[model samples]
Target: MKKILVVGLFLIFACGSESKAQAPDAVKKTFQAKYPGENDPDWHQDDHGYFEAHFKIDGIKYRADFNADGSWVETETSIKKKDLPKAIKDVIKDKYGSEDISEIEKVDSASKGVFYDVEFKQKGKNKDVEFKADGTIIG
Candidate 1:
């Protein structure tokens, strides 16, 4: 009985300690303000020392990054190909009709407007395309 109690206490402490290892209070507050109901999210420090939150809403997965000062940097979310704009789909089909789309992510940043990053595979080549919300290609 004593061993079981000790194990239980250790497990609780370990779980709680993991949350304490998350980003700073400022970052958490910023994330909370940005995504009000998304209280529980996976967090990690990026290469640039920013905090990244991985969460899901309405069945869509998203990642929001906050800088050290708690400023929102950017956000990315996966999108379905069928949901893409008609012009964007037309362009992709015209350019790489033979390729298979592997992934499509919509990214919004403070420095740039909303855009989609599409990753596709063609034969033996892998490529990525960027498209603005207006369905215009941007490199």
Candidate 2:
């Protein structure tokens, strides 16, 4: 009984630590260099193996993603519907005027450049749509 209890406890602790793994030193340094003076970032590993740092700047929440080798992948911040670009707003008004926007995020990425992620609830399910600055749908 004692042996079994100890093994169970050990497994629990090991699994917990794995889930709470810290970001690599290189990633931390890169983050500091990019956003100096901003501290207290909560780090997590995303599904794509990227290190994501959740923090706020000037009271605006931001999530910055960095590669394990310290390369910046992207940074995103939530924005209001009214804050969207005029072209995007027009497109949404024309196509999805009836549907309410659930959330909006402005993403700046290294590969795909800058884009907006707009989410809407359709048929009791959430759907995300990506758009470029010119209101062209990318995905």
Candidate 3:
């Protein structure tokens, strides 16, 4: 009947509108605008109607994604220099006698607190160490 046809048409339009609303640029712009940073968005669409964006804003890197319905999926903050724990740096200085190290990472633990993981090259040997929050060796 005429009612069935109208309902079908409305459903089609509604679905189309929903699809349009999930565009990657719209999500990226929303983030950039709210955060006041550059728009660096890389979008990926999957079978589950999810999209992901890897971007950096205000010197901090982030990965943010949205679902098909334009809702936020998740966000992961990138580790930066300022986020490194001081204990790890102290351990490197004490053990290696030099502060020349790379790939310093700080990992947070529930009970053990924050730990520093780093890679150091010395005397032709590459060493990896883990230090506790208070500059004590945990590895």
Best of the candidates, lDDT: 2
Each candidate: what lDDT? 0.85, 0.90, 0.60
Question: How many pairs of residues collide in model 3?
Answer: 0
| lDDT of each residue in 1-139, candidate 3, tens digit only | 9999999999887664223333555566655554465544656564466665666666666655566445565555535445656765555556776645655655543345556667676677767777776778887
On the 0 to 100 scale, the lDDT of residue 22 in model 2 is 84
Q: Residue by residue across 1-139, what tens digits does model 2's lDDT show?
A: 9999999999887664224448899999999999999777989887788899999998999999999999999999999998999999999999988888889999999899999999988887888999999999997
Q: What is the Å distance of residue 76 in model 3 from its true position?
A: 9.6
lDDT for model 1: 0.85
List pairs with backbone clashes in candidate 1. Answer: none
Off by over 4 Å in 1: 1-21, 122-125
lDDT of 1 by residue, 5-38 (tens): 9999998876642242388899999989889999
Between candidates 1 and 2, the TM-score winner: 2
Model 3: colliding residue pairs? none
Give lDDT for model 3. Answer: 0.60
The TM-scores of all predictions, comma-separated, are 0.76, 0.82, 0.37
Provide the global lDDT of candidate 2 against the true structure: 0.90
